[model samples]
Structures are given as structure tokens and as C-alpha cells.
Target chain A: MRSMYKSSLIACIVLISVLASYSFAMAAKKVELVVWDLQGYSDQQWYKNANKAFMEKHPNIKLEFEPHEGVPARPKFISAVRTGNAPDVGILNLYWVKDFAMNGWIQPLDPLIEPETRADFFDGFLDYASYDGKLYGLFTETGVATVLYRKDLFAEAGINPPKLLEAWDFEEFAEAAKKLTKDVDGDGKIDIWGIGISGSRTGGGGPTTFTQFPFFWALGGELIDEDGWPAFNSEAGLASLQLYHDLVYKHGVSPRESYSYTWDDIARGFSAGQYAMALLHNTHAPNMDKQFPGQVGAMLYPVPEHGITSATTAGGWIYSILTDDPAKQQAAWEYVSWMLSPEVMKSMCADIGGLPTRRSVFDDTMFASDWNQVFGRQLEGAHMKPGDPIFPLIQDEFAVAIQEVMMNQKDPATALDDAERNVVQRAKATDILK
Target chain B: MERKSGSLKQGWPYILMILPTFLLLGLVTFYPALYNIWLSFRNESLRTTVSSFVGLANYRRVLSDPFFWGALGRTVIYMIASLVLRVVLGLALALVLNIPQRGRSVARTAILLPWVLSEIIVTAMWLWILDHRTGLLNGLLATVKLGPYGWLVYPGMAMGTIVMVSLWKNLAFSFLLLFAALQQIPLDLYDSGKIDGCSSGGLIRYITLPLIRPTVTIVTIMVSISAFGQFSLVYSLTGGGPLRSTELVGLYMYQQAFNFLDIGYGAAIAMVIFLINIALSLVYYYALRSESLY
Candidate 1:
């Protein structure tokens, strides 16, 4: 009996040792991955849900989410990188990835991503986050600048409706815009404008450039030439500026009051039925669908010719890893890869009704609406802003000319020439024309 | 506790009390101003990793830029315009409120509402009202055959609208101070002026304005400093735009610092603005040295 009791006690001792070691191993496996993003208010729930689902799947990794806005957020991240305390992973605008990569603040994800994973995302977006053949990020939320128009208004005016299958030429588009403009109140003032173009230089130069760059592209103008010099003084640029001016002054489709509007104001005005057509991003699809229901129409930007080369600017957030710790790098890759996967992306894009960066994610049918399908197809033709590290500063300098021309303060040629000169001087000062 | 020995020892507790206050002020205000001054003499930009001592090159660059001088000119104009409007409107409101009229408490409370809210909030409220289309002001204008004017778009009108909004936000403080000053002035002065065959306007010129001279100087200095540093309102409202018609020096410094990413040049602009504010304050201080309120 005493021998039996001794064996049982020995077994209890063995069980306690094994249990303690297992608990220690589990404790050592705890990995805390910090992520910063600019998801906005509407998309916060997706991040929260992703965090819970990711943690449950891994059961050893804790995801810490810090959401921020765009303008103020970029500088904060830059400052963190300067201080050597940036988050393990974060989302930044694709334009900023160039500058961050130039400064060597963010690490290249090329070495981290596998071949199959790399094949999952579109090459058009992958090129945006690449600097000198090193892929630095994978775009998560993508947007394509496109024309949002009124289907009901087109019907009421008996216009050949714009379609994703065939975009309207500039001449036809201008004529249609003139017909849609109306003074329904008989007050001698136009109540409904034909187009919503943001003419304000408010909130920096971004709003003016994002909405107007497509028109410049269609007019055969380039913001910067192949040699990385300001080429906005070309005849095509003058024509594009003239087009913007004529919309306000000659065509009378846009109002003089629009000079006070920002991009936000333009969006609000479009929603308030102030404009029959507006240039907006694919990110605006869900809101447009909800507000105007089946009455809203989507189309690629009208080109100078109906079927010739068309262009739309693509911009949005890309997930970048900022840490040098290999363990943390692996953990961050897991989070980023999971976030960019087809299943997770389909869930997020469906929840927010946002444009997906990966082609495989769109096959889920949640984004199979006509509007979504159109914007999704346009992603193949969309490209990043010309490869310049100082593109934001360039955009700012160029906006003065756009504002001057649109406000009728200066003619297009003089304004474009002056803007190009200013850009040249600034580029020389910064010493980074490329 | 026992009695302290030397004068310095006796003042130890008082010094300890004020020490934290000084440290807080140094951390919050003086340190940043000095650091900015130090930065103004260096070459600091995002493109360069190491900042080198440039010795007034940043200042030279900013001073030579035409945008800087234009912004400075507008800032001076903005300060003077805002100062004039605030004093005049504040004095008028103070005089009216000090008359002991009906609903006087309600009026006093309502007068302080604009000043109590933050400048950004007030600017947003004003932006909605002053928007060119579908604004309260424009809607009211439409009732008549009047304008749905671009009040915040036209150059001169944008600056004027900013000044008006600044006045609306800051007038209450001046009004309260002037009102307090008015109360301290015995009613006997006004009665005596009346007894001596003085007109109401005459009484105000000699008795009221003279008595409020010191308070007006304080009000001018306070309002001028606040207006000189106005950043958020213009940053949010007009973005100093319509071709920078309303670009204050503060907004110029921000665009230089962050947008242009040249911290040295931005610091130079700030130091210049700071020096100008000090000179203006000194001038006002000497100009309004009151000669006995009696």
C-alpha cells in the first residue's frame, strides 16, 4: 500500500512539471503586433472585427490598432520613424510611400512576400509601392478616379447615356453637360449645375489636382515629363486648363460659387443634388448607391477621343512594415498578408463597399454590382501619379495656376508657364527633380 | 514650525510655490520660442538628415520670397482691421449693455457665447453661414432681389469676412472689460457733465472715452496678439485662398514648415512675426499710458 502511494505522488509531481513548462511555452509565444491605419469612421468596425478574428485564429498574437486621419497622420508617422519608434505596421497613402521609401524609413516587403502572395495583388498597384525594383507595400484599399453622373437626369434630357462599356468623348460630354444645366426656379440664377468640379485651393492643393488630373491626361498633357521636369506649360495643358475654365465661364455648367468649395464641399454639393455630374473616386460608390439608389450612373473619364487612351489616377492606403526585428517583421507580415487575403478583403470591401486592390477579391460577387464592376475593371488602366518623391509639393505649386485660371485671375497659358517656372525653381531648391 | 532665520530662508515656501508655475511656463511657452529662434539660424529640412548652421540664410530666403512680404502686409492689415472693428463694436455693445435695460442678464450671457467656443468651431459655424450657395446669409439675400454673393471667395470680401468673424469671436472679452471700466466710472461724472450743459456725445467724448482709455489699450493689445497668431480659422475656412488674398503670416509659416518641409525657413518666419508682435505691443503700451482716470 505504501509503495502504491509513492508511485501516485511521483505521477502528480510529473504532471505539475509538464503543466508548468507548457504554460511557460505558451507565455513565451505571446506576440503583440502594433498596427496604425487611416480607416476613417465608417470602416473602424472592419478593423475591430479583423482584430478579433485574427487573434482567435492565431491565439498567440495580440493586434493593437491605432487609426488616424490622412493629413495630420502622415507627419506623425514620419516623426515616429525619425524617433525610431514607428508602429510595427501601418497604412500610408501610396504617394507618401515614395517619400518614406526615399528616406529609408519603411522596409521593402519584396523579401517578405512569397511568390504566390505577390501574384495575388495587381501589378499596377504593386508598382506604386515599389521604389527601385523593391516592392515596399501591398495596397489594401484602392480607389480609381471616375465620372459619377445622374442616370435620371440623362433620361430626362434625352441624352445618349454614358456607359462603362463606352465612355463619352469630351465634345459630347460637354454638350450633354450644357443640356443638363437648368434654372428650375425661374429666379435667373442656375439652381442645378451640370458638373461638380472643385475649383478651390482650400485644404491645400490635393482637392484641385485629384479631380482635374484625369482631364489633363485626356487632353494629352503631363504634369511632369519623362525626364522629371515640369511640362505643364505644353499646349495640351493649356487646353485642359481652358476646359476647366470654360466649364465655369463659357459652358456655364459649373458655377462661380464653386471657387469656395473644397473636395468635401463638392461631395456634399453632389449629394445635395446641386450637380448633375461630378468626378469622384470609386470609394464614393456605396454612398452614391445608397443616396441616389439606381439613379446614379458610373463612367470612365471622358477622353478626347471616345475609345483612345484613357487614364484614371489610383490612390489609397498600402500596408508597410517599419520594424527591423525579425520576429516582429514575421508577425507584421502575417497581419498584413491576412488583411490583404482574398477572404478578408472580400469581407472588408463588402462591408464598406470600397474598391478592392486585388482582382481575386472581386470574384466574391459582393462587389459584382454594375458600378463596382465598372470601377474594378478601370483599376487595370489606373496608374499612380508620376514617379516623383516630391509629387505632393509639385501638386501644391501647380494648384496656384489651376486656381488662378479657374478664378479668371490669369489665362491658362500664362498661369501654366508661371507654375512650371515655380516648380522648376522649387525642384532645383529641393534638389530632387526625379 | 519654528521661525525661519534669513530672509532667503523665510521666502523658501513662497519660492517653492512659484517655482512650479515658472517651470510650467518655461515648458509650455518660453522653451518653444527659444528653440524656434535657435532653429531659425540652422538648415533643417526633411531632405537632409543632418542640420547645419546656416546663420540667417533661412531668414534671408524667407525675407526675399515675395509670398512672405505679401503675407506680412496682409497680416498687418488684418490686425489693424480686426482691432478697429473689435474696439468699436465692443464699446458700442458695452455701452448698450451698461444701460440696465430689460433682458440685460440674457443679453450679457448671449454676448459671451461666441467668445466661449473654440475658434475652429466658430469658424466652421461661420463657414456654413457664409458659404456662397445654400448659406443662411445667401438664403436671406435671396428673399430680396439681392446677392447669393461669394463672400468668402472674392479677395477683399474674404479678408473682410475673416475680420468680421474674428471680431465676432473676440468682441465679447473687450465688451466685458469695457463694461467693467464703465461701471467703475461714477455716475456723478455723467450727471455733472449734463448739469454743465454738456451734450450726451460731449459727455462721452470727455468723460467716458477718457476713463476707458486704459481698458481700451489692454483690449487692443490682447486682440492684436490673438489675431496675429490666427491659424486654425483661416486654415479651416478660406485656406488663405482665392489666390492667397487672406494669407496671414501664420498660415504662410505652416505651409512653409509642413507643406514645403523646411523647418528652418518656417522658424525664421515665426521669429519675425514674434518680433513684430513685441514691437506693436510696446508701441500700444506707451501710446495708452493713462493719466489718472479722474
Candidate 2:
């Protein structure tokens, strides 16, 4: 009987040992999170450092990284959401938020975001995150269009670049472009163009409408009415397009080649000393600064003398959780909330050379010595594109018209009229008409 | 009929062996085509997962729009232009390579190089070569102190450049087919023409052209069909630009469906294009009806 009791005790001890080991293994298993984005790649130190710190702090978790760019990225994001195979969190463009929210592919973040944390960001940025009366994301950076120039080139040509306080109007901007446009090599052809703007998929009121829409808006042109119907084919719209045409065919200051340049090409060309000025954004300023130190300058977009429009594109990248599992969502929220902290936001915004979305980040030491002084002033009136479902369609139509005018295929009046007609016609076939 | 049924019953295992392939093909090609046809008749938007049938509305919308017709015209023009350039230049290159000369084998192999190049690589290369501010073409022009022409900025220039790029990309296909046809023209036929005191030109007209008819017809039709459905070249080249100067139907349909989120309308456009391709195939088959070329 004693021998049998000893055998039973051994068996029980083995079972208890196995159970304890299993418990330890389960506790040590690593949690995995994923992050996907495109912007952080070109300059990755910000993301790399943040990711490194996060991983160090949470040694029991793994974060997978994926990145894609161009127009095709949107469809990939949507497909990920639909399949519920999305990253724990992702950097999303504001344009896709409406479609994503409407399809039930993403959850509103009203529960994750507190009123105090929400108030930290500017109203315009928070407004970009909110759709249908609920917050779906947290804005991470400031995106607004601005005029970037070469101070050295401006000085050589005896033309002063525009300032944030005394911004140049339409005529003054044109005069500056002409003065700066030069045949530096004494060749008959122009060696350096005065100003460059995107006329293709990169910019020019189509795919990246913000780059060109503000040009029209600065002249008092509105793309859509409050009813979300076409409203751009007015006198103001025609005048804006006419100004573009004059710059191309008449003025000869803007490069005809701008029509072929993509968004990346515009900045690269400017860095190559091919243009005197570029209509780009603060998002691009840092990269430009890297390529040509002390060569980049910034100002508000050129306005017309009378109306003096202050409208700028307040578009910014937002961080949001995509997991459907409640536990995973909470975990993802932890990573997101940490990234949204003022320190991380400032570091990232500084690295990207864009304006900060958070009000507190403006007080960071880095912002004091940078171009934020001008970019911040411009942000006061910056606004996101309309949150309408058909905005993409509207932008495409507007882009086609802009391309037509720039290429001299149609006059401003003809192009805008045709575009307005096309948008209205297409809108009637869908829910956007209402 | 009884024998046929018996054969079918005996071939059941063969059918089973090929079933996976058939299933794959059906899923990838046939299913998508049918689903596209169904989408053409529905109202789909990003706002809803469920779509409702709206028969012929999308078709009506496409037909009534002038831009659709305008784009269709451009597609037809681009297709024909690509076809002619490919045939003429390809035939020339093939004839030159067919000559009995030194390094002919090397030249023939060299002709196939462009055909194997990735489309994106070719597009990027051309973009660099033709950039307005820093293009090789402009640099060469500056040698003569001539114009720095905007190769892709102007509408007409953009259209011509896309055609040229397409010709460059597809030239090898035409050359290879035509070279193969040239080799099979029986030497005796040419000998007979020579015996009749025929000139080189006469020999080509009498013997070469007649014997190569079937092959030439096949080559023409095949290249035309491929060009008719061209997308990647235009997409990467000018993005149908300087303002829709190069916007082929494929890019238009893509923009409508994917970019603009008008999937149903895009699907309708796809169906229309499919029918157009079918019609084109029928026309070519009739036009080129002949005995086997190979």
C-alpha cells in the first residue's frame, strides 16, 4: 500500500509540473501588432525610432510593418478592412475615411478618444477625423498647401519671395515668376523655369486636388455648393483657369512640362535647380530642405489683391485601429494613444517637416527654429476637402478640366463648363445628387 | 450519338484530370467576366455592400455621354496607329534581319530584346528620355541649338509619343512572326522567279507576297487585337494625358470603376469594351479567312 501511494504521488507531481510549465509558456507568448503607411518610408528615422522605443518598452509584443503608395494603396486598404485582415493600426488618408466609415469596415473612435485628448488637436484637424457625428481617427500631422521658393534664386533675380505677413497677390506672384525665369546658359531656350505645378496624377486638382484647388479657392472659386452639387463653373473659376493659361502660353514662366510631372517629380525637379519656385506643401518642405540645405522658402499661396482668400488644404494623415476583436482593438488603442502623445507627435512632425496637428506640439523647441512660423500662420484658415462621398468624382472632373486648360485644348470657360456638366450628369446617376 | 456518349463515359477520367484547370479558368476568367456583366446592370456605390438591379441605366448613361464617344474614338485611333507602325517598322526590321549577311543571327536575337523588357521599366526609361526639363531629346536638340520640344505636354505630341512608345514595345512580336513567315517561303519558288528573269522587287511581289499572305493576315489581326486592348502602355506613358489625349477606353473604365468608385458603371463600360472586342475579332476572322498559315 505504501509503494502504491508513492507511485501516485510521483504521477501527481509530474502532472503539476507540466501544468506549471504550460502556464509559464502561455504568459511568455508574444502579442503581435501591425502598422502600414507610405509617407514614413521616404524619411523613416521618425517611425524607426518610435517603433524601436515601443518595442523596447513592450518586449512581449511584435509589430509588423507594411507600406505602399500611389493610388492603388486605397483599394488595398479597403480590401484589408473588408477581409478583417487589416493591421492593428494604420495611417489612413482622410479621403478614404468616409467610405471606410460608411461600409462599417471601421469603428468610430469616440470611445477611445476622450474630450480632453480630442481638444489637444486643432478644430480643423479634429473635424477631419469626425464623420457623421463620431470621431473615427486621430490626426497626426498638419497638411496644407504653400509656396516654396529658392531664396538664393530670388535674390539673384532681385525679386523678393512672398512673406507670411505681406503675401504676394496674383499679379505680384506672376511678375516674380517672370523675373526669376532665366536662360542662365545664354541659350535661347529657358534653362530654369520660374514656377512649377503638377498637372498630372500627382497634383493639379484631380487626384491630388488640394495642390491645385487652393489656387482656384484663393481666387474665390468654390468647387461645390453646400448641397454638394457642382458649383465651379463661375466667373471666378474661369478667371482662375485663365490665369493658369496665361502663365503657360502667354507668360511662359511656368513650365509646359509641369503637365507631365508627378507629385514626386515636382519636388525632385525643384531640388535639381530646374525651377525657381514650386506650389507644394509643408509635407514636402523637409525633404526639400534635406536635398538642398537652406534653399527652401515658404509663404502662403498667392492670393488675389481684392478678396484675399485664406483657404488652404488642412488634409493630414490619421492613425486608427482596424481590428474587430475587442481585445486586439484595446491593445491597438494603446499603441495609437502612445503615438498620439505630444512628444511622439512633435518628433514625427519634425522629422516629416510638416505642420503639427496638435496645439501643444507647436511649443516644441524644434518648431521655434523651423519654417513652422509661416506654415502655422497658414493653418489658421486651412480646411479639409468636403467630406462628400462623390468628392473623388468631383476632383477627377475638375482635374480633367484643369488639364485641358493648361494644355490649351480648351479655354478656361469651355473646360470648367464641360467639367461642371460632367460632374452633375454623373452625380444624377448615384446618391450624390441629393 | 451512342458512340459519342460511350466516348464521353470512357473519357470521364481525362475530364476529371483536367477539372482543376477548368475550375481555375472558370474562377479567374469566366466568373469575373460574368460578374462584371451582372454589375453592369446594378447600382453599386461605396456607401452600401448590397447592390440593386437597375437595368440598362448604366448603359444609357454611357451612351448619352459625349466623352465616352470621344474616348472610344481615341481608342480606335490609337489602336490603328499602333497597328500600322508595328507592321511597317516590324516588316522592315524582319526583312533586314532575313538578309544573308554577317551577324544576321546576332541581329535577329537582338530584335527580341525590347519585347522581353518589363513594361514599367520601358515606361520609366522613356519618361526620363523625354522629360521636358532634363530630357535626352532636348539635350540632343540643344546640340543643334533647336527647340526643347515638350514631347508629352502638348496634346498632339503626347498622342504621337504614346504611339511611338507602343510601336517600340510591340515591334518584336511583329518582327518574329514576319521573320518566321519569310523563312518558310520555299526557295524553289524564288528560283523559278529568278529563272524567269524577275527583279528582286518582282520576286517579292510574285512569290514572297503571295506565299506569305496567310501569315501576314494572321500577324496583322493578332497585333491589331492586342493593340485594341492596350492599357499598360498608356497608363504608364502619359496617364491618358495632357488631358485625355491618350485616355484609352481601358484607362477610362479603370478610372470610373476603381478610382472614381463607380464600379457598376465601370463594369458596364467593361462589357461594352468586351462586346467591341468580340465584334472586332469577328470582323478580322471574316476579313482574313484563309487556309492554315503555319
Candidate 3:
């Protein structure tokens, strides 16, 4: 009887110890979170530092940051979401939020964002983020398009630094381009082109589309209806395209080669003195400043008429929490909120040479000064592309139509008609017709 | 042993032997192919949560797409242009390298370097070479005072450059095959040709060319099929650009499926590509049969 009792006590003690250790092991395991970003290899160091800072605060969370190679990120992001393999957080072009949200691949961020937190972001940015009356993302970095010029080129051409809001419409812009365009070496070919606006995928052909498209928008031309149906065919739209044609074909102000230029191509060409003026963005301004030192100047995109109210396109990257886990969601928001805080936001923008999307950050003396001053003023007129599910497809069709017209594959009227029809059909198919 | 019954002893081992490969094929290929076919007949969109059968609509849409046609034509052009050049150039190089000469092994190894380099690196290098404003080609042309010609900016030139780059990256396989074929020609046969008053050209024509024709045909068909599916080099280099001039059906289908989130349309395009490859293969088989080369 004594031996039996003793053995039973030993077995019970051993079972209890085993269960306790197993429970402890389970409790101690760190929560693993994945984030997909397009920050690229060059920016990997910054991410590492930021991630390290994040990890130190939250010891139980392990964050994995994966950077995509290039433009393929869009497709990769879409595929991951569809296959239910999307990361806990996704950083992408702000334009993608609508498409992702529309597809129901992403959760509405309203549950994560509070009204007080929402108020901290710039109103224009918030407006851009909200689609169909729901908040889906947090905007990061300001992407305002500006006119970057070589001060040396301006001085050499005997042209004064451009004054504010002065309408340098089509003709004036062309004249400046002609005066600045010089072969210099008598090589019988253009050694220095006038202006660099990509007709290529570098900017998604955006320079031509963005810098030129705004003129049409300023003139009251619209590409799609409020319902995301086709609407670009108009007399005003042709007039907009004609301006581009005249610039490349007739005036020879813009480089015909811009059609093949990429984003880096435009900036590098400018750095190499291949072009006098580049309708570039603040995103690229820091590099321009570094490359040319004091030779860089900035202004709003040239207005249609010198005095016309210039409307800049609101663009930027967005960060969104991609998780169903409440703890991970809270942790991701912590990172976002920390990043968006005025102190952090100002420092990042100053370091990266972009605009801060937070309105509160504008009060910072560093942000209130020269370079940031330019960015702040530009942000006012900046507008966002419509946050419609069909927007990306619409943008692609718009680009194709513009290229076709510019390359003389189709007349403007016919090109617009075809684009309009394709877009409507696509929208209908996607059930966005209503 | 009495005749083996239909028993576990007889059947179990056969099942075990074939099971692994069968499972792997099912896992890797068969399932995905069936899924894609199923996706083709469904209405898939980023907006909708539900997938519904849309039947032939996706196929009709793909057939009517101008971008699809443009991309298909470009793919065919790239396929034919690259394959023909690869075959001719590869054969010529193989013949030259096959000569009894010093450092022939080194020559063969050196020629294969471009083919061995990673595709991304090759693409980055070519992009530097063809950059419009500050590329090496433009700079060299400037030295001759010939032109600041926009090599990559020009639509036609851009497509040609992409094809050329692709050919450079893949031509080594053709060269190796042809070289092997040349080496396989019996030494005794060449000696006989030499004895029969065969000069260098005559020897190649009568003995070398006819004998290697089989290898040449095989390489042509293989290269053509590979080039028809060409996507990466073009995607990396031109991105089917300067006005979508270099767009291939592969890139288009990719964009449709992934970027546009139109899986049904994308799958339709893939099926079209499949049909095209099948048709090309059939035509090639017919050509081979008519010549009775096999």
C-alpha cells in the first residue's frame, strides 16, 4: 500500500511539470508579422533602422519586411491578396488602395483609425484616402508635382527665374524650350533638348499624362464620369492632345525621345544637361538638389494661362494594416501612428526630401522653410485621382489612348472613342457601371 | 510460383513505385491547369466577392481586344526574328569553333558567358547600353558625329533592340547543340568527303550540312517556342513601351490577370497562346514529315 501511493504521487508530479513547461513555451513564442513594401534595396537601411526601433518597443512581435523588385509590386500585391497570403501590413502607391479595397481583399481601416488620428493627416490626403465614404489607408509622404529647372540654364538663356503663378501657357513654354535647346557643338543634332517629359513607362508615361493632363482638367476636360464610365471625348480633350503634338512634332521643344524615357531617365537626363526643364516632383527634388547643388529651382506646374488657378495632382504612398489579428493590427497602427507623428513625420520628410502629409507637421520650422515651403504651397492645389475600383484600368487605357494619339496610330477623336468604349465595357463587366 | 494472383503482393509494389511521381505531377501541374481552365469560364473581378460562370464572354472579349492583337503580333515578330537569327548565327559560330584550332575550348566558354549571366543583370546592362539620352550607343554615334539617334526611344528600334537582347541571352543553347552535332559527324565521313574532291564549302554542303539538318530543325523549333513565350527580357528592358511597341501576348496576359484583376480574360489569353503554340508545333511536325528528316 505504501509503494503504490508513492509511485502515484511521482507520476502526477511529472505530468504537472510537463504541462507547465509546454504552456510556458506556447506563451513565450513571439508573434510573427509580415509586411510587403516597395521601399527598394537602396532604402533597405532606412527600413532596417525603423524596424529595429519598432522591435525594441514591442519585444514580443517579430516583423518581417519584404521589398519588391520594381513595378511588379502592383501585380504581386494583387496576387498575394487574392490568394490570402497578403502580409500583416502592405505599403504601396496610394492609387492602389481603392482597387484593393474595391476587391474586398483589404479590410476597412475605419476600425483601426480614430477620428482624432484622422484629423492629424492633411485634409487633402484624408480626402484621397477615403473611398466610398470609408477610410482604408494612412497617407505617407507628400508627392506634389513641381517644375524643376536648372538655374544655370535659366540664367544662360537670359530668362529670369520664373515668377509665381505667371501663366507660361503652351506658347510661352515652347518659346522657353526653344531658347534653351541648343546643339552647342554644331553636331547638326540636338545636343541639349528643351524639356524632359516622359512619353514612356518610366513615369507610367505620367509626365506627358500628368503635366499635360492637368491642362485639360484645368480647361474643364474630364476623362470619366462620376460613376467611372468613359467620358474623355470632347473638343477640349483634342485641344489638350494637340498641345502635346505641337510640343513634340512642331515646336520641337520636348524631346521626342521622352517617349521612351523612364522616371530615372527624366531625372538623369536633366542631371546630364540633356534637358533645360523637367516637370518633376518633390519626390525627385532631393536628388536634383544633391546632384546640381544650388542649380535647382521649383515652382507649381506651369498654368494653362499665366494666371489660371493651377491644380496639382495629389499623389503619395499609403501604408495600411493588413491583418485579422487584433494584436497585430494594434501593433501595425502603433508603427503607423509613430511614423505619422509630427516629430517623426518632419524628420522623415526632411531626410527623404519629400513633403509631410500631416498638416500639423507644417508648423515645424524645418518644414516651414525653403524646400519644404515649396512643397507646402504645391500641396494646396494638389488633387488625387478618383478613388474608384476602375481607376487603374482607366489610367492604363488613358495612357494607351494618349500614346496611340501621340504616335499617330489613331486620331484623337477615334482614340478617345475607343478608350471610352473599352473603359465603359470594363467598368460594366466589373459591376461599377451603377 | 503459381501464376501471380491479382493480390496485394503483385499490385502494392507497382502502386508504390509510381505514386510519388504521380502525386508530384498532380500537385505541381494538373491542379493549377484545371484551376486556370475553371477561372476562364468565370466572372472574376476585384470588386466582387463571388465568382460566377460567364461562359464565352471572356474569350470573346480577349479576341476583340486591340491590345491582345497588338501583343500577339509583336510576340510572333519577336519569335520569328530571334529564332531565325539565333539558328543562323549559332550554326555559323558552332562551325567556326569546331575547327581544329588553338584555344577552341576557351572560345566556346567565352561565347557562352552572355547566356549564363542572370537575366536581370543582362537586362540592366542592355538598358544602360540603349538609354536614349546618355547611352553608350548614342555616345559612340556622337564620336562618329553620326547621330544622337534615339535607339530605345524609337518604337521600331526599341522592339528590334529587345529581340536582339533576347537572342543574345538564349543563343548559346543553339550553339552548344549545333556544336555537339558537328562533333558527332564521324571523322571517317569527313575524310571520305575530302578524298572525293570536296573543298571546304563542298564538304560542308554535302556532308556537314545535310547530316546536321536534324539538329538544326530541332533547335529552330525549340528556340521558336521559347521566344514565343518571351516576357522577362522585354518586360525588364522596354516594358513593352515607346507606345506599347514591344508588348507581347505573355506580358498582356500577365497584365490582364494580375494588374487588371481580370483572371477570366487573362486565362482566355493564355488558352489562345496555348492554341498558337499547338498550331506551330503541328506545322513544324508537318514540315519534318514532308522532309522525312526523322
Winner by lDDT? 1
Model 2 per-residue lDDT tens digits across residues A326-359: 7667667778877888878888776667677787
Q: On residues A289-334, what C-alpha lDDT tens digit does candidate 3 reach at each position? A: 7888988877656566755666667666788877878877877777
In model 3, pairs of residues that clash are A103-B46, A166-A306, A167-A305, A167-A306, A199-A258, A202-A262, A202-A263, A314-A383
Runs off by more than 4 Å, candidate 3: A1-32, A41-46, A68-71, A111-114, A164-167, A201-208, A408-411, A425-434, B1-26, B197-202, B289-294
Candidates sorted by TM-score, best first: 1, 2, 3
Better of 1 and 3 by DockQ: 1
Candidate 3 reaches a DockQ of 0.42
Model 2 TM-score (2 dp): 0.89
lDDT (tens digit, per residue) of candidate 1 on A1-434: 99999999999999999999998996778788778877583266776677677888887777777887776576677767777778989888777787788778888897789998888787778877898899888888777788888888888888867655567788888898999999988978787888888877765677677778877877777777678777778888888888888888999999876665677777777788888898887777568767898888888777788666666777777889988888888888988898888877877777766777776786667777778767876665676675464566568767788888888889998988788777776666545563
Candidate models: Cα lDDT each: 0.81, 0.78, 0.75
User: Which 10-residue window in model 1 chain A sums to the lowest lDDT?
Assistant: A425-434
Candidate 2 chain B: worst-modelled 10 consecutive residues by lDDT: B285-294
* Candidate 3 structure quality by residue, lDDT tens digits, B1-294: 455665767898998999999999999999988888888888875445577999998888888777788898888888889988999999999999999999998988888999899999999998888776678988898787766666666787888888788877888999999999999998898899889888999989888888888787788778878887888887888777867788898888887776666777788888888888888877876675436432
* Top TM-score hit: 1
- Comparing candidate 1 with candidate 2, which one achieves the higher TM-score? 1
Query: What clash pairs does model 2 have?
Result: none
Higher-scoring candidate on lDDT, 1 or 2: 1
Query: Comparing to the true complex, what docking class would candidate 1 get?
Result: medium
